[model samples]
Target: MEQIVGSGKFTYDVNENWAHVPPGIEMKPAAVAVDSRDRVFCFNRSNEHPVLIFDSNGDFLMSWGAGMFRYPHAIRFDAQDRVWLTDEHHQQFMQFTSDGKLLRTIGEKGHRSETGVPEDDFSSQAWRQVTHGGGPFNLPTDIVVVPNGDMYMTDGYGNARVHKFSADGRHQFSWGEPGTGPGQFNLPHGIWYDRRGRLLVADRENNRVQVFDLDGNLLTIWPTELIGPAFFYVDDEDTVYIPEHNAGMFSIVTLDGERLARWGAPIHKSIHGVWGDSRRNIYVVQPGEWGRVRRIVKYTRR
Candidate 1:
């Protein structure tokens, strides 16, 4: 495993070597996304610059997207290399270019509604409530891009549902409800489409990951023995990494839901997100102290 720490303009790598850090940018980074060029993008709330770019070796590049985000919680890279971000407080999903150019924004701010009733039981209505006619979002936490360029967002917190959008930001379909049933979710915080294009939702408060098809069919569920399974990441090898916020650690499981390896220090009060790089280095994000003292720790196979 390797570790790196950054504060103000100073960054120290695993060997305690001084590394290049961006200037005039500081925030408790809650999420990170790496591009195909290996450039790192850090998303944090405090920095007026919501997105900070850095080279693989920690060289300071540039920063942008100021004044556009409200509690930017997670950042992800799409197949086309475009960047997608979730603003939980703003209740919206945003797309940006690699250079931080705002491409599109979906969802309305401060709009709230009750959806997924028997009348709107079809998956399509859930998508409309989030994308078309501008229905209110309770809190949108995470986003993922499908293999075909569509997008899937977890509408958690206030509302329990998942909304899908086409590549052009059109509402495609949506599913989920605020129950503990097979297709229900309690704080569906993080979502991702696996290699097979199957959707996996981290039913956070429920402590399980519910698998569903593109059409909202409940396929399977992976129950976690721990509480608060907040986020999930499926690797190219079909292994799943799940981070439990309550436990302050992450577990690696097979696609079939068998526990493999687990690692972390109990010192982490809350683990929020997880991501893996090309080299299979696992990165965990912990947002702490009102975003004042966040940390990203990298782990590797022992």
Candidate 2:
């Protein structure tokens, strides 16, 4: 029997084998993005094939970035269809042409910021000691380029901060610290800009989504208890799709943060990333346990 997920107008049919991998080629997709041509790109952790490209019909197209990344954390396409990737393990972010040519790189490779205290310090540590608007990145998890060419990155893992930069790769300003306050973040995992140009951050560890203006002022925060949001995909109609790892489900919400729908495999807790293309087909990356099928599943609206 064909399994279906979601409800109402958001329901979809799951295609587990949407894209086939060659024999002996293991992949654990860390992030996913679609370009203007609807070409799907999967950023995987494997050094042998760090980036995998696929056509809209799920056919494998090409692979690149081998021996060029330590950890493929996130992928996003700019307005010009250029690709931007973040390597968390290497603590660097890079830009590439659509044809896989390196354009620019940011951050000092393999170096972590001297700031940020471990979990043991808890909330007692001074905010300045943990986050001082450091340079480059400590361990960036995700990035987004605004329409004006300004860039923002969630400096994750080693540093709890969000850095803003120019299109030409100059750091402009940064904000956030390690705490539970209004401007603080635990693990600001995923980020996206809405049509109104407001920034929405998936404050993963805090189990909430924080909204802020481009200038770093906290606007609002929506509590999403039990849903550890790992990533986001805001559709053309302003619908937000969040891959919640802790809840093992996708939480569908509106631009104003209203929960509209939720669905996923209740027995599985592997959904780590999500993206949707022009046709409204949703793609999710499930990095299943050790030997399981670490694959990207396509959900077509029924």
Best by TM-score: 2
lDDT for 134 in candidate 2 is 53
Error of 1 at 204 (Å): 0.3
Off by over 4 Å in 2: 117-135, 223-226, 287-293
The clash count of every prediction, one per candidate, is: 2, 0
Measure candidate 2: CA RMSD. Answer: 3.7
lDDT of 2: 0.80
Model 1 TM-score, 2 decimals: 0.81
Q: Counting only residues 3 or more apart in sequence or on different chains, how many pairs clash (N, Cα, C under 3 Å) in candidate 2?
A: 0
In the range 227-291, model 2's lDDT, one tens digit per residue, is 77888899989999998876677789988888888877644475777889888998898744333
Off by over 4 Å in 1: 1-24, 114-136, 223-226, 287-292, 300-302
TM-score of each: 0.81, 0.91
